[model samples]
Target chain A: MTEVLSGLPAALGVESLLAMLAGTLAGIAVGAIPGLTATLAMALLLPFTYTMDPLQSLGMMAGIYNGAMYGGAIPAILARIPGTPSAVATVFDGFPLAQSGRAKFALHVALVSSAAGSFLSAVALMLLAPPLVEFALQFGPAEYFWVAVFGLTSVSLLLAGAPAKGLASALIGIAIGLVGMDMITGAERLVFGVRHVAGGIDLAVLLTGLFAVPPALAMLSATGKHAEGLGMTGPGIKVRQALGFARTWLRSGLIGVTVGVMPGAGGNFAGILGYSEEKRAARDDSMFGKGDPRGVAASECANNADNASSLIPTLALGVPGNSVAALMMGAMLIQGLNPGPALFSQHGDVVYGFMWQMLFTALLMLTLGFAGAKVFVHMLRIPSALLAPMILVVCLLGTYASTNSLGDIWLMLAFGGLAFMLSRAGYPIAPIVLGAILGPMAESSFRQALLISQGDPLRFVSSPISVVLVIAIVTVATLPLGRILWRRLRARDARRAEHPPPLRKDR
Target chain B: MSTPPYHGAQVGAGERLLVHAAVAALGGAVLWDSFSQQGASAYFPTAIGCGLILLSAVSALKVVPRRLLTSEATLVKGLGGLALLAVFALLAGEAGFLSTALLFIPAMALLGGDRNVPRVALATVSFVALAYVVFHVVFAQSFPPEFILGGR
Candidate 1:
């Protein structure tokens, strides 16, 4: 407690606080844009932090992390396009609220919930991180290998609807990860004599291309079709309304934080679960699909809270909780910080500074989001024709800036084309990105563990941590499948009962 | 929801088979390369390749399967856009930033179904000029010189 209190002053210096505010503002702007995410914003700003104090640097990044999560809600609410994948589930009710002349109320709900969610998660992180780190310290290479495999399996199985497609995407991602020099043998696997390929694909560049550019291109392709109607502009909800929403959706916020801490369960899942739970709990359930402030509040709060708590596992265990968190971990690595228990011990000041900054950043997000509500809503008025071109330019510039290589631009175009097709065919893009991100790490760790154990398969089960991870992985993967099967069976039974099936047809 | 009429259009079973065969061949190549590597390198890629092949086969086997070739117009547009992108990449090393971007952006936009060719061309030119000023002049970043037109 003394150590924590003593560290607070250095962490909360005026300069650091100011930086955090600025970063939060910038993160919100970047994240509100359809193609930009928190990870991209962090990666872009990382180079600028090279010369700053570690605490100040982390302050800015932390602010971005919290603010971007909130920023994603902007596009989700207005355009039915989620600015970040975490906001994907928000669009279900958020856009409908906007369409029903409750845009201001929706924005208010999102902003308030986001702030509340971040606050809750920041508290959780501060309270739980040390113990989590202590527990994480017991992991070995075999354990890490299993953890990575488990993360990949759970993410692929649950997140992507088609198991086969998800596995394929994961495999492709691993293949991409194999593009650079081999870690153990020092052999170039698939460089094809290209020096840039030898360095391997940057996760930042891959993400910018895979997630950002393709969607922008897709938008451009469909730009001729205009978005109909105007978003609402009014005084929004009164204090009493907002407070009522907060009181009603408090449990959803808790669920969000809990789900966020769980590996592989992301904001999308949290938002859906929260929305359903809130609807079920509502005294008047019919108000849910309408412009219900509580409905939006529940989803927005859970998603944002989930986003913050998702970082807990990544920071403590060095195992990313989701794709966005994985990208954050990648950014940390790019900044020369090794994630895990050592990160907390070696960079306690920086890590704690980040925790403190997140609280202030959440406050800043609330202020800016509420104050600038009109400005953000007005962004929806821009014609898709003009917006599409600008998005393309940003995508090109972002891709180029990451590597300064035109090759990356070509790679982006190719992937963009492939992604556009996949999306059109009803295959989800998120799992592919997750697979790509987790693929190499899992493969390398698995191989290393096997080699260390002289190719013994039982080595994984021998370790307590690995056994626990395997069990967790199995439970996560199987539970979802079981639930899905049960739902199908129930649906079949319902149809049979309703139709009185075969007897009538035979008669 | 009723299936769209475009769903049952001209892609036949043979073409679908060919596409899956091509994907399988790609997987095979990857698998062969993976096996050539030392230690467990083979396992990862081989697993991935096999999975890809399996998925591609499953997809191919579905009746009225989702084929790569959707419509003649869409196919032409996609191929044309891909070809233009390839040309742009090839020309990037030789053409100056302004010339390449001015030509490429409008062409790609046009292929993307924008009918206002002249407006797209103008916008592309304006954007390229702005980009050049920002990146080369203001930002002091070096770019490829106009080799085709000699010096700039």
Candidate 2:
């Protein structure tokens, strides 16, 4: 505690505070832009942080994390396009609210809910992280392996529309992860004699290319020209109104927090769940989907709550809950801060300092979010023709900065092309990105567990955690199959019901 | 003016064929390499390679019933952009940062169907100049000097 307090001055110093402010502002802009996600923003800013103090860097990154989640609502409300995947649910009601000339009301709802969610989650992180980490410290290699398996399985099952494609993409990601030199053995396994490939592709460059560039290219191809005519002209919903909405839909916020904490589920899911719950419970349910402030509040609160709570698993177990958490882990590693149980013990100051920074940053995000709403709404007026090229240039520069290697640039282009192709084919890009992020962890842990068991397959089910994980993997893998079967049976029953006369004649 | 149902079926077939071939070749390469490795490296890659081949085959088969090429214009643009990217990668080392970026950015914009030549040129120059300043001057990071343009 003393160490945490002593580190506070350094963490909250003038320079650090200013950096946090700048980062929050930048994150808002980046997250508001379509095709520019929080992950990209974090990756782009990471190289700049190489020279800064660790605490200051962490503070800035935290600010970006919090602000970007809030920023996602900007575009969703204004353009009807989700700035981040997490804001997909926000578009359901947010855009309608904007179209109804209540852009300010929707923005206000987003702001208030985001602040509430972030504040609550920050408190959760501060209070719960220590104990969780202590508990997770008991996990061995087998348990860790199970945890990774569980994470991957849950994400694959819940996120992917097609189970086969998700598994296939994940398998491909694991293969790509195996391209570099082997960790236990110094031998290069799949480098194909290329020296640059020996380092493997950096996750940042890959992510930036996969998620950012392809979408930018696709946007260039999309020719729908709708001028953004958003104005700040509706009945300005006061804080009291927003709070009233929150008071009525408090259960939705709790649902958001709970969903946010669940492994593999993210803000997008939480938002959707909260919105549905709120609508179901509302007296005037018809107001939803047509533009309602309560609808915006429910989604905004849940999405932001999910954003903050998703960090819980990442910080405690070293298993990221989502892509953003994974990116945060990357940033933490780049700053020489190891994640997991030992992180709190060895770097409590940095960890706790980050928690405090997140709290303040959330407050800063709320202020900036509301003040900059009009500006963000106006930014949608920028022509995609101009924006797309600029995004590509930034992506190129960011990729080059990661390694200063031209090889990486080529790799980015290749992956960008592949992603473009895959997306056009109706394959979900999220699974691929998530797979890339988690693949290495899964493979290394699996291999380590295998080695410990002397290649015995049953050893994976030896521990209690491993057994639970295996069960989870089976459940996740089979759930979709079960659902399909149930649907088919239901359809058959309906057919039988319709053809009762023919069945009676056959009998 | 309704279009034919299988208007793009030929393209789908071609894509499926190409993907299957690539998958098979890549899988074989991976299998050969993995088998040459010392220990469990062989198992993982072989498994992954086989999985990839199977998935690609499945993906290809799935596409056979539907239109593979969504838009002819997009296909041409995608291929052209890919070619431009390849050119940029090849020249980035030899032509160095500014020269290569000058060529790459405009070419990409043009290929992407931007007809505003002046805007494209200005964007290219500004981006190259800003990149040079940031990478070379501000950061003092050294990049490969221009070889074709004769700068050291």
Candidate 3:
């Protein structure tokens, strides 16, 4: 702890701190806009970091990750549109809360949860990285595959209206994930010989399309004379009730850290899982589908929790947990720092500086989210007519900036159209994005596990870790059916008690 | 998740039937496509496709058609907006982001039914200026070829 804190003063030096602040504010702006994403924000900034001291660059990227994760909730609350893919579930409750003019309270809850999640995860990274990474390293490919499936099943069962539609949407995402060159055979599987297929479909492009495009279209769907403003005012519950805060934050934060430490599972899974669980556990679940503060807290906290723990596998095992961590790993390499066990011995100061940076960045997100709440609430004043177009412009530009590729722009539009369709049919889009993110990881891991076992099917169940993961997945997947059956049995008992089954005319 | 207020083209009975059939057909296509591939690549997608087919058939039979229908007007307008975006993509690379955005913003506002000239004008000018400061000034990056200024 002392070592980490000692390194923090150096990062607090003027230039590095300014870089962090500037990066975070820019990230907030990018994230508040529909179609832009944290990954795209990080990718765009990666080049700029080449010129800075590695510590300074790492701090800025860390700030951006936390900043953007919180920023996405703004539009999710205001426009029923997710500014980032991770914010997709945030819209479930956040926007509904906003619709009834509780936007400020929801935003406040999101900010608080994001900070709590990030801070705790940062602390975990500081104190427990070695042991946690050691445990995480036990996960073989089979385990990784099962872990993703478990995450996917939990969220799928929690889908509100139609489970089959959720599954179909997930299949669409996996199909999209199958595009581009085969990682194993080096042959084209789905791409129709297009030059762009080799690079594959960019997640940012798909996310921007799936999330950003639909809301703008929804605005145009309105035929009425345009309203001058959103009619929003006042903060809705600035501070959450004490009990709700503790339970929601703890549950979601744990889910976030657990999922974040796993390589390739990513924060969206954590956010979705958190949201689904909170939705399930809420006493007044009618509010769960409506605007519930717990929803924002769960998803926001869980996503930000990934901010710190996602670095665990990256720093300790030399395996990037997700793409943002991949960029951070790239920065480490640029600084002539190698990850893995030797990294601790060789660059303890720099690693601790990174941890302190995560802690400080979470604090910054809280401060900024607090001060900026009222100002951002003013975004509702932008006329509905003009607001939609402005968002459209931002989305198009952000998607283009994500990669200099025009094909990505095309993919964004196509997915945007797809989002419009799926959403109309009342299908949830979160599962689709989750499936896309997890699809490659699951498939590659499954295949690789099989290959390692020389095509032995039993090998998947042989390892203890894999066995536990398989059991977890099966149990979680069957839980909804079990609950349904249990409810039916109770209902039958209630009915029998009410009628005595019978004043049965025969009796 | 709560559904967005996205009214797209309403699916009539005939169209709904066709749409469901089309979904099944697409699944079949994926299934057939996966079957042709050898070894590992075939497995995941084939499972997904076959599942999609079964799900689609079951959804068509069990779920009401009303759940599948979206608003026609919204659908047409949204797809139309996408066409406008495609135009921006085609032009932005050559014309410069500032110039392309200036044209694109007002055009979309109009498409979205905004006729307030002052508001449209204000948005165009402000967005351009903001993009200038954010992209060109602070980042010191090039969003170059100011169409009005000619590759500045």
Query: Which digits, one per residue and each the tens of the lDDT, describe model 3 over residues A267-319?
Result: 77788999998888878778786877888899999988878898886677555
Look at candidate 2 and tell me the lDDT of residue B101: 69
Predicted candidate 2 versus true structure: per-residue lDDT over A1-507, tens digit per residue: 454465466667787788788878887887776656677677566645656677778778888877888788877887777777678778888888888888888888888887787777776677677778878977877788778767766776676666655666666566667788877776787788878888776776767667666656654554424235456658766757766875634666677668867766887788788888888888888878888777788877777777667788888888776767777776787688767888888888778777778778888898888777777666555445445656666666667766787778888888888766655554555556556656666667778888888999887777787787788778887988898999999999999898765434554
lDDT (0-100) at residue A399 of candidate 1? Answer: 58
Worst 10 residues of 3 chain A by lDDT: A224-233
Pairs that collide in candidate 3 are: B7-B71, B8-B70, B8-B71, B8-B72, B8-B75, B9-B71, B9-B72, B10-B72
Give RMSD (Å) of candidate 2 vs. truth.
4.4
Runs in model 1 with CA error above 4 Å? A1-103, A192-195, A223-232, A238-240, A421-428, A477-484, A499-507, B1-23, B62-84, B96-99, B103-142, B145-151
Give the DockQ ranking, best first: 3, 2, 1
lDDT of each: 0.68, 0.71, 0.72
Error of 2 at A135 (Å): 1.9
User: Number of the top candidate by lDDT?
Assistant: 3
What fraction of the real A-B contacts shows up in model 3? Answer: 0.40
Cα lDDT tens digits for candidate 1, B48-91:
77777887676556536444433222434444655665676577
Q: Top model by DockQ, which number?
A: 3
Model 2 scores a TM of 0.88
Give the better candidate number (1 or 3) by DockQ: 3
Error of 1 at A199 (Å): 3.4
* Native contact share for candidate 1: 0.15
Report the Cα lDDT for residue A348, model 3. Answer: 72
Clashes of 3: 8
